[model samples]
Target: MNIEEYRLYCLSKKGVTESIPFSKLPNVLVFKVKGKMFTATDINTFDSFSIKCEPETIEELRLQYDALEEPPYFSKKHWSRVVVDGSISDKILYEWLDISYRLVVAKLTKKERLELEHL
Candidate 1:
């Protein structure tokens, strides 16, 4: 899918906020839930995005999908870079994005989660 599609999908999640926190890379848009980043992509290129993934299943996912790759600047074990080259379906892309969001939300502090629940 394209950048606008990606942005709208991410924003559709509860409590998600978009920001360009990096001054040096202003085009890199980060999507976060309750201030914790879940995924990010370069708006200028719209080529790929980095997302958090389950470490236990990450390698298997990489092996299963050619579009999945090591992220440029994130922990190789916990994050994946998914190339948006039309090699994968939009449904799979949305599923991966949902997983990333849920993983981050799962790690939120009790109070933070409660805050999110109320939001």
Candidate 2:
């Protein structure tokens, strides 16, 4: 999928918000929930983007697909920045998005969870 499609997909999740936290890349859109980041994409150039993933599945994804550990910007143990080369299927990318959103949501405070439920 393209950058706009990817951005829309990420933002469609409950409580997810988009911002440009990385100053160096003004076009990079960081998707977060309750102030915690879960995924990101480059608006101007969809070269590659990062998503938080379960530690156990990180290696499996890397082995099975073209996914790789995120670079110096994010923790390698729990983040993988898959290159947007059109090789990875949209289904797998959506699953990664779900995983990232679930991971962040799972850490939400009880009140935050309730607020999300109301949204």
Each prediction's total of clashing residue pairs, residues at least 3 apart in sequence or on different chains, is 0, 0
lDDT of 1 by residue, 1-119 (tens): 89999999999988999999999999999999999999999999999999999999999999999999999899999999999999999999999999999999999999989988887
| Per-residue lDDT of candidate 2, residues 41-89 (tens digit) | 7777888888888888788878887655555578899888888877888
Best by TM-score: 1
- Misplaced by over 4 Å in model 1 are none
- TM-score, every prediction: 0.97, 0.91
Q: Which ten residues in a row have the lowest lDDT in candidate 2?
A: 64-73
Clashing pairs in 1: none
TM-score: model 2 vs. ground truth: 0.91
